[model samples]
Target chain A: MSDAAARLAYDVIVDLVGRGSRVLDLGCGDGLLLARLMAEKGARGTGVELSQAGVQAAIARGLSVVQGDLDQGLADYRDGSFDWVILNQTLQSLVNPSLVLNEMLRVGKSALVGFPNCGHWRARWHLLLTGHMPQQASLDYRWYDTPATRLLTIADFRSYCGERGINIVREVFLTDPDGGRPTRWPNLRAETAIFVLAGQIEGRPRQRP
Target chain B: MQPRSVGIVKTEYVELFQPPNELRLDSGEKIGPITVAYETYGTLNADRSNAILLCHALSGDAHAAGRNNEEDAKPGWWDDMVGPGKGFDTSKYFCICANVIGGCMGSTGPSSTNLRTGRPYGLSFPVVTIADMVRVQRELMRHLGIERLMCVSGGSMGGMQALQWTVDYPEMVLSAIPIASAAQQSSQGIAFDVVGRRAIMSDPKWRGGNYYAFGDPPLDGLALARMVAHITYLSEVSMRRKFGRRLQDRERYGYDFATEFQVESYLYYQGDKFTQRFDANTYLYITKAIDYFDLAASKGSLAEALREVTAKFLVIAFTSDWLYLPAQSREIVSALKVNNVDVSYCEIESDYGHDAFLLEVEEQERLIGNFLSGVAREHGIA
Candidate 1:
């Protein structure tokens, strides 16, 4: 696969992974992103995939991956064990995205979370036009069979971070990594967004927006 | 039982040290002319980097796979996972399993006569540690011209050796699979071993480890030890499924204490079968060594112990294995994670308990096969 074969969101996430840093990829499916991150960024990577087949595929690629449920928590990992903990395309599928987000920041010095924005204009337009839940490639599955239990938008994530005192170190819209950060209406324009976050220190003032 | 092509399979013995080339034990005692019984499957490539060391658990021999003779009814202990197309995949990788130093199956143990005393070492044998066991295996590897191993894989006590190899000789190993093992033997584990030892020592036939001259050979004591230890290897769920409160060979219990329960009969059979082959003194020595294996205590903490490890690790645990619970494996994983060691862990769902490493074959086969293939690719081993 070419370096550009990764999803548009991964391209942006890979850039922020930096060089030679340790990474823990939560809900790593087939470990493609971790493998790409390792190859391109010189990052030492580990994956925690819940499925046996996914774990097998990752191992086949010569990647280190453990099989475990994210909902059960990352208790096996120590505090700040990894330089970056990534949750890509998996945030919406989590049983408790809030608790998992807390764990991601607990185990990793910095967390990079990528998720589809439910509040995208297309989704909103589909809901307004058809009077039903949106169905798109980013959120492709039917509501009945979908693994996504929680669907949140960029606005929702920003608010959650604010409430949890999580410092948003960096945010990038999937459609534009090099372009200036989408300052005006990312919740409406961006299909998916990646946020680099760190837990706020006790004495420091929280970053609200 | 299926028809499968076998690989190059044979067992051999090698004398590592001589009178001059003494092997100094961790206790600072010396033993030379040590013999190690080993079996190898598949061919070692020119570089000899395709070798995967398979360490055996307690009561396990060097015969890891294949049958010794046509008349033999069963294959090696880990036959399901060590053949041509099996987990270790002898067809692609050269696999070696050696009888540990303090074992009874052909390796120099309490059963072997000491060169200096002209008699079995018995109680006089220098107590061996997990590290010492690895040291002996290293000597065997050196003698075999294997500069580095592709991977070292094992479970339980075997897993301890695998983990020890990673900590002790990190550069020499490319990867490690330590399944159903812990960084240190838990206190509860020690208590079980203590009871096992007590049963052996209490036997009048034991004669303070000088019972080799007698005909009986402390069978009762050794059988009792095996019975106790075997129970620990299995889970309550498995026991309930297999035996429950069922009676042996009858519709109802005889009501007397003469092995009425089917489980009792099964344990008796296991105990009897074990005594037919195993040496009682070796049981004492090996258990003592296993109990003494506290990697964390020796190296400070598990993190400190694994701090310098460069080899990737796959640490496996079983859900119901109370003997070496998943919690223990997690401790090792936590340390590896803390030290930034590349590690993978799977707490497999199984009712087989600690014996799951031996009994629950499919998941391990898949995991190990994939992990080994991955490691082989990394090491450029065809």
Candidate 2:
């Protein structure tokens, strides 16, 4: 009955957030991770969900969530308003994941981004044999019906961080929620990846750029 | 966790202030000997921090839940959400719902006699605003010896009171849930109220609100006002779905305006039933209070108005509620964010319109119960 225990990502996410921390969860479906974080870590969280049902479900669980689109941007929030901003299994589906990640960094002291690694062994084998976009546990739909708008791998995301001058403070590779094995080659072995990041700290007030 | 129903509640009254301790209105005037009619469920814990004050909407009375007696055909207005394990959960938290000061239902409204003239105060009663209503309730809370409340909540006008409590007495309220309401009255809402008040004032029998002395009340005017007010509470979708072009009783229309449609009959029935219990003067006064309500008028900005609010907030709006649209609730949420307040918002998907707060019981129960549970946990209520 406790859906919180069923998701291993929630355990890892909850562990990363500090006790009594203020959290902002983007694309927080039903707020399962946020709810567990509140109960276990005594954290307070606000969620933004595009789906009405997800918003209601989050509210039903006693978490404050707003019905809003991620593409619309987080203009309503102030700078560094939250201790942590979380986006789990939702980065790849967004219209502009990079912009959202930057906005998250602006509004939160730290950001946690989780996404499915498209370069996993299963996805690679399926694409090589079938010559069609692969679908597996993380990508559980046909190419046409998939919500994963873009494909990304552990390496692509790391390079994106480097190019944008974003710092990856921590990284975790998971084959699946139940399979928490750490891998030497995440892009080839891991089905999913989570990264904790901090935006480049300003050394001093920028003088014209 | 589904809450079990708590059955058979009771209502009581308490005299809060008298003479020297007269309740002061936001307008600087004062009223003496205020008697608050209220209903309480569950027991107040030793610390008394488990108390929740439930403020009612326009026509709602203090009878918020449970049946008063076996003869009563229906339970209270919020009966579904205020039981043993329901949204307000009478078992764990002490719930208090009071009839507002200007209400006609067993409260010191215009219907009460004026000690100076020994006649119903009627139009002579000083006009009170939403802030005045909250001030009276605060006095009532002091009378009951509860220093701090676990939560203050309501929808529509009730939501205004909840919001006001947070701004006016920030230290008293621990949490606030303002459902389907706004920080200020919308122009469209004011227009509706204008027509309703005109309906009463234009009636010949109204006699400038002195109809009480004649004992022949302006039932037609009051009924018409209620009819006009009721239309705003529903949406076009609900009206189309519920009545459509369906005829009333007869197979065919009478070819005249003799209650041809079922929707007409329903409105007439609702309006007629309303006249039996409500006072016309009270309708005029309360509606005026709602019209005059603008929290930011004196504070310069909404953020400034709510700067003192420390209580955690949950602001709810319904998608189909055009009277108090979701945008209005967003204004509140935006201001709260500007002040860096702890706030959460949800625009529920409902076609029930302004009445969704009353009709969407299942959704309200879950959301409210969980919110209250978290707050209760924080206060060590469990």
lDDT of each: 0.86, 0.86
For model 2 the local lDDT of residue B324 reads: 95
Task: State the DockQ, from 0 to 1, for candidate 1.
Answer: 0.48
> What TM-score does chain A reach in every model?
0.88, 0.91
| Per-candidate clashes, comma-separated | 0, 1
Candidate 1 lDDT tens digits, A86-137: 9988888888887888888877888888887788788999999999888855
DockQ, Cα level, model 2: 0.56
Tens digits of lDDT, candidate 1, B240-326: 999999988888757777878889999999999999999999999999999999988877788888888988898899999999989
Poorest stretch of ten by lDDT in candidate 2 chain B: B1-10
User: In candidate 1, how many clashes are counted?
Assistant: 0
Deviation in Å, model 1, residue B338 alpha carbon:
1.6
- The C-alpha stretches of model 2 lying farther than 4 A from their native spots are A1-20, A35-44, A51-62, A96-99, A155-163, A177-185, A200-209, B1-10
TM-scores, all models, native as reference? 0.88, 0.91
Pairs in steric clash, model 2: B6-B84
